[model samples]
Target: MKLFRIVHPLNGVQRLLLTVWVGAMWAIGYVAAPVLFAAIESRMQAGAIAGTLFSIVSWIGLLCGGLILLVQWRARHRGLSRVALSCIIAMLIITGVGQFGLQPMMADIKAQFPAGVEMSGELRSRFGALHGISSTLFLIASMLGALAVWRSAPTDL
Candidate 1:
């Protein structure tokens, strides 16, 4: 009983939660964010500063997720040495960077809604579609990372 007590109750929960979160974020970032951030125009995909704000929020979210990964590591590593600390850390860093620093560099990504910039509904829809594709890829990567950790768990290690 004492030995079991030593184990984290959320032994599997952390990775599961991570998987779910990644999927959810991918959907939000790729689907919801663009829809909400960009404005509809008749011909071009034009958006306001809201898109930029979304990017900033995204960076903050990634940074926060990295921090959560640290907590997950400390909580789950007692008997699971095969799931190395360094690998998890590295994954967190990579994801954090991509989420935080990469999305803001789009060619037409404006800082805010310009007073009179013309945009099209199709463009915003296209942007959302592309964002969805990228986020789906990101979600896949996160799932693979979680699966790697799970598969690496050794009975003795």
Candidate 2:
């Protein structure tokens, strides 16, 4: 009982969650997104599907990251806790901006110029700029997540 008490309930679960977060991110973003675009005849359809996947992945990231932070806190690993918190914040910020800010703006731009119509050059340029920013932020969050997982691992030393 004493030994079990020392072991947090979410000990190994944190590792699993972290694995799922990172794996899904890479698999969906890199592999599935491209495949979706290729398989789908319409760019709009492909974009919608990809965006939904990204949103789901972002939620998963938030859940896993939050739980991992809790686990780190329970372990009293202050440094690890800090790292986890930072990673979670980065993930949340990236996801929020992409979902709420960029996605909406892109949708508005697309709406302004429906299918078969030439999109406004200014709107197109703005959408492209937002896409680039979102992509960079997402990439940074993904890398931070990987780093957080590495730092959370048990160190034999």
Best by TM-score: 2
What C-alpha lDDT values do all the predictions have? Answer: 0.50, 0.76
User: What is the Cα-based lDDT of residue 89 in candidate 1?
Assistant: 52
Candidate 1 per-residue lDDT, tens place, 63-107, comes to: 545655656667755433444444445555555555544454333
Give model 1's TM-score versus the native structure: 0.44
Could you give the C-alpha RMSD of every candidate to the true structure, in order shown? 7.0, 4.0
lDDT of model 2 at position 5: 34
Number of the top candidate by lDDT?
2
Which 10-residue window of candidate 1 scores lowest in summed lDDT? 41-50
